[model samples]
Target: MITDPEIDGDWDTAQGAESPERLTPRERARGGPGVRPWLWALGGLVVASAVWAGGLYAFGDRLSEPTLSYRPSKNLCEDFKARTLSGLTGDLHKQRPMNQESDHPAVYGAVCRLNNVEGMPDFVVAAQVDLHKKTDPSTEFDVPPLADIATIGDVRAEAVSDLGERAVVLTSFGGTEQKLKVLDGGAVFTVQVSVSTYNEKNGRPATDATAVQAAMIEDMRALMAALRK
Candidate 1:
């Protein structure tokens, strides 16, 4: 009775029996039936790229904005009032003081070098101001002063209060040189005074170390005020 389904008129039943499904010519031209998975993978990659780009844009904007409250001085030598140092040394060098200033997107800096008469006390005073626009300097601010003790013999460093967010004073070379550093917000201020031992041998009484440090602190406050204005 089953003489041969193919030869019989029931050929349609034989053709539909146990045959695997096949894609149309149109489907094959469009990358077969698995193309939807490929499209989904591509769409996921695009979304991830967009999210990464947005994050970078937001972070860059935050870094570009300045966080400092104080401003940079056009001429540090002219703006700084060295009354305390002048009172002790009599007068600064007649020649123009050496000064440097810079303004940039990430930072602002000013520095001034004031020296006493050649033979008087022969002292040198250096003042500097730094305004950080992007990052906080507190973590690294105290490292240098503290490191001096290990690097140099007879160096002393102590923390100071009431000057700013944080302050430090470093004295070296038997109190002949003193540096005062203060950090406020994102601004860093430093005042350093140093005198040579030759000045003591030349019959000029050695300047009082205590008085020198006090004068430095006083002048630093004045300098900060001037820059703020």
Candidate 2:
């Protein structure tokens, strides 16, 4: 009853039988037949999670904001029709089809310029549509220092009420321009009606600022209503 040396070899030889390469932390865990498969699976899951987190950190804002597509009716002039003051009215002229262009990330905008036939003060209407972005339009609602916050035509708006029918204006784009911004259906609609009554060219009064402002408000109101339809 004798035991062979090869069969009952040294424990060091048995341990070194697998491989001589240096094993990494993961490789060490995958060394033997007795190694649990769940551990390998868990390691894989951890790697996947790290990749996903990195992606989110890199592109969070862009992924959240949706891209806007263009449509023919979304053109600036066509969507916002040309209008003139009722009594002071002459001929209403609409410029070329205002193309919808990207204003900012996830925001598309366009403006339609309208000129008076009688050489009166001109008007411009602009629209900005947010392409399903979660951005709040109220950020653009900031008015001038003394501007009044009032409700016009069932919508709460910030305006220069003291202008008293001369102009319904607000501060925007770093408070450099005076305009109207209406937030509706993931879009911001803006209107700019000239407040000048005296023609700069002839130095004579042409269109009434008060009348032009009133007409601008009504025209904007009508456009907003149309968007709802």
TM-score of each: 0.64, 0.44
- Clashes by residue pair, model 1: none
CA lDDT, every prediction?
A: 0.76, 0.48
RMSD for all candidates, in order, please: 10.1, 12.2
lDDT of 1 by residue, 1-229 (tens): 6674356644444343222257677766666545567787899999999999999887674455446768788888987778887777755645468899888767789999987755454688989999988767765786765445565556678888789889989889688778899998689999988777524433344568887888888898898888773
Instruction: Identify the leading candidate in terms of lDDT.
Output: 1
Quick one: best TM-score, which candidate? 1
List candidate 1 stretches off by more than 4 Å: 1-66, 118-121, 145-154, 198-206
Displacement of residue 98 (Cα, Å) in model 1 is 0.5
lDDT, candidate 1, at 94: 54
Task: Give me the runs in candidate 2 sitting further than 4 Å from their true place.
Answer: 1-73, 84-89, 94-100, 103-105, 117-132, 143-168, 171-178, 199-205
Q: Which ten residues in a row have the lowest lDDT in candidate 2?
A: 148-157
Cα lDDT over the full model 2: 0.48
